[model samples]
Target: MTDALLPNILQFIGQIDPFDKIPKNALRTLATQVQITYLGKGEVIDLCTAEQEKSLYIVRTGSMEQRKVDGVLRAKLGPDDMFGFSVLGKDASSDKGYRAIAIEDSLVYIIPQTALQTLFSAHPDCAEHFASQAQVRLKSALDVVWSNKEKGLFIRTVGEVASGRVAVVTADQTIQAVAHEMRMVQRSSCAVIYDNDTIVGLITDRDMTKRVIAHGVAIDRPISDVMTHSPLTIKPDDLVLHAASVMMQFNIRNLPVVEDNKVVGLLTTTHLVQNHRVQAIFLIEKIKYAGSIKSLASFTPERQAIFEALVDGRVAPEVIGKVMTMIMDAYTRRLIQIAIDKLGPPPCNFSWIVAGSHARNEVHMLSDQDSAIVLSDSATDNDRIYFNHLAMIVTNGLASCDYPLCPGKYMAATPKWCQPVRVWKEYYKKWVSNPEYERLLNISVFLEIRTIYGNSEYETTLRDALHSNIRNNREFLSTLVNDAITTNPPLGIFNNLVLEKSGENKKTLNVKKYAINLIIDLARIYGLAVECDLSATDERFKAANSQNALSDDAFKNITGAYQFILSLRFSHQLEALKQGQKPDNNINPDSFGSFERKHLKDAFRIVADLQEAAKVRFGSR
Candidate 1:
């Protein structure tokens, strides 16, 4: 390559990463040694089972289609996208490897692996970005066959396992005596009131200690005076895991089991810990025991087993979510290591953020991947190169693992989505301060971000800033409310079922998009305004109640709406996964039983009513 053409060649590679960090001299040398290849449309670039090499290929122009061994087109890659870096990694597994072929006449830049490694070593930021991207990709690949084997595990109703022994006290009983009965029975908690075959209140040891002993209040006071009235209770026939969530969310040790408005039994946290048989005991043990990723990977097979256990255990949706989050987190970290081994290293300090359902820690079997990168503000031009490369690696890796790329271009690899921490903060400020239609949409999407890997403190700082900005901005809150209200559940003109325009059940509507998103948006706005730290929509609703953000009636209506939507989504996904179909948000109401349909309709009505109230509150503004 001549000096005159050297700058152009360097510029093209610089547009990618780590290469951007190479000095002018080294880049010129690299340009001289690199090869530029051209291919006509329909030409094969690399076939399946081709000899692997330690080099990277960047498309200078045109596009290519990646295919599987069965000849199915899997992905399309355009200019600026690169491939073949995985050859640099230590992993020898290639059974599920992809083959590349030109879709259109294309020009490509190929760089030797040694040169790329030299660049990465000289510019550590580039290496980091490469590593991060690779890790994300590996994680995605692993998720594909990670196994949901535990899907059929035993799920029994609370009524089936109830001890049939009740520990109860009258609402008029003294707190002192109630505490005595609790301790004498070796129980951490007890139901406070059993009246007319109804459960009116609950009092636990913590409540007694905090409300009476700590406050220096007389223990002789009526239990009703210190009891938690109208406490969050579940029906006896409900899933035990649901009860577990109520306990975890409330930080309580026990929950009252209500049957036909009567207190039947008390469910303790200890009981669940003792009885729940987790299949992937090894995975859980590894996660709890391992202090590093190296150790965590040693139990990778166990991780798969754990996933199977979760599928089979019939664990409550909430617990399943928690477990999945833990596994995914570990998986992502390991992939990052693999990417780093392949790409070399990062150009600068950065954090990989998880968004959407995963960020909220509510991922289901069919969930897609949503993530972004937050680089340090001090990152130089060289840093941008590495970060961009890292993003691509992670996004593509995730695609291989069964998480389809976010159709909305919300993946970490996109420049618009990847930014320095300071830039992200500025972006948040702009969205919150302006609160325009587009900005509001961006805020709604980004606010759901949760730190899944790297520098978690950065995520915390960003979240705190968001809370501070939104809490003080009444106008922004109002705008959010207005935006949230716009997507009201679609109720038919005759107040009957609103059907879909197409699909197997053409007459059925998607409850997730219309109903669930409505509640999620409403809860998000309320939570933001109140500076609630909880991430999940359901958890946010509960937090909103504690903060008195909604009236008791409104709270009940929304809670019921949330539960109905959740149940519907769970069932739909369960059936879809069972049939080997891709789980999706689209749901057909007609497929549901009459009672289920009625509950869904009622939920939508509640959502519609709340939306109207929201409009009245903010639409006028």
Candidate 2:
């Protein structure tokens, strides 16, 4: 390899496994021995031939297809896919006649047997990796990709990538002082204005131009006069997506990150654009103003692309769910707004409520409609007619835009679900007072709700009332826990993924039904039992754990399982999209490489332990 490309190659190989396990100096030496080659279409290399058998090939670009002696295709390999599995064959003189041919113009790197042997002797793990059977080799390779991404991306929290030590100024400081500070720093374009250590405002250079310079306002005036008061803020622990959303929502270029009543740092558009490749942020803006059902429907491909980006970025499932939820939030609100425009304003104050995955903000690619209308107490028959028509329009529009209609008729388009706040409370009253099996199903769905549109007070009053009832009503919570445990996580005694052996989903795990729903049920039970308002699964577990409603280990096991199951589901959907298929919940265990197979077993074990813990906690309640 040329020295110009050697550093890049060495850095890449250093991250991938077998190479990663080897020392840097050894990798540098191996980098020198690498021979890069280009091939045109139909260029064949006989891997089984004695002359080529001793060389290992890695496809750096384009595709190479391997075939058996009879010309039946064995596999198609692309960038980063390793081949020449028999490079260290015991019988070097034998020819097996299986050959790999470049199906397109290709670029590949070859490592000769001599250099490989030297490196292998120094690092036995590298040798063992290459010598392993195909199954084992497949696993190690995947593990390499995953481990490198883990160490590289670290997509957990804003704190992971945020800059430290934000600049702060007092609210009473003069605009002149703020402008001077902005100029002095030169590099940083913004500053947070604080009062008693609480983030009161933020001032960016743009603000200085639009508010002060343009208006020719006296620069000697207090910074509060020109600063953006009560600016939208984020936490250091918040996801970078949150910061991006705040910036997008408020149409501001910077946000003051507050943690524990202190400004921790400033997050700028520059940071987000430089660091994250998330497209969902851009997608949200488009949905907000999309007026027609046809325009909204056109984003189906971009919606899929959003999922693909999150999956490829190795973002955590919880964050992925929230980002997707944020996108749907845009869709839901815009639909409601469009509906309102067409149907005229509502007859009374109301809140558009979204429940289930949408409510919990744990949405995946297949998130369907789960919504209701909570009208004001003064609503009448005319109001009912107005809302019923409105729900039909909005729900239908959502369906057209890839949000399928709710299967159980749970959507607000149904007249019964479109009701006044008082009537809604009555429904909760009856459901809680008598938790019959059917009513329990509704309770499970309704318990987690997010008010996407209209008067926030309506949902707040209803949720407060619900929480109040759940606080002392042990019977209601008992029934909830009982319902939560009705379907235990589908795991066999041997800790294998227990899939349906018969029926349409035969030989596949219904990840949504068994793994995802089970976690949701537990979170609902624990959250309601503890009277915690949070509906997100991870937050519910955290709240319960902090309150000692769950043991430390129980909390860890359950939340860990939740994350893993959701991650698997996202990956599955992404895989489906790549294959030009519709994404769904069913996953075949065989589809997973051994890396996922091992984690799947461990995740299921955690699920089992979680079920046991939930059972014990509610056995007497």
| lDDT string, candidate 2, 56-139, tens digits | 777778877777676754555655556675446553334264688987899988888788889888886777566523324443
Computed on alpha carbons, the lDDT of every model, listed in order, comes to 0.65, 0.76
Worst 10 residues of 2 by lDDT: 488-497
TM-scores for every predicted model: 0.52, 0.71
Please provide, for model 1 over 1-621, each residue's C-alpha lDDT reduced to its tens digit, 9 standing for 90 to 100.
456766788777755544554577766666866778898998875634547565677778987766656675444556666666445545435435557788789998877778767766776544543432233332222222233344432345566555555567777778888777777763645654765556678887777778888999898888888888877777786656555544543567776777777777777767777778444333443444444445554664454445445544444455566556655654565556556666787777788888877887776665677788888788887788877887776667656544567877877888887888888888888999997887876777788777766777778878988987776676887787767766657543121235566757565566666777788888787677567777887677778778877766567667656754665576676677667676677766446542343344445656776676666655535
* lDDT of model 2, residue 594: 33
Top model number, lDDT? 2
Candidate 2 global CA lDDT score: 0.76
- Backbone clashes for every candidate come to 30, 0
- In model 1, the runs with Cα more than 4 Å from the true position are 1-277, 280-314, 344-347, 492-497, 503-505, 616-621
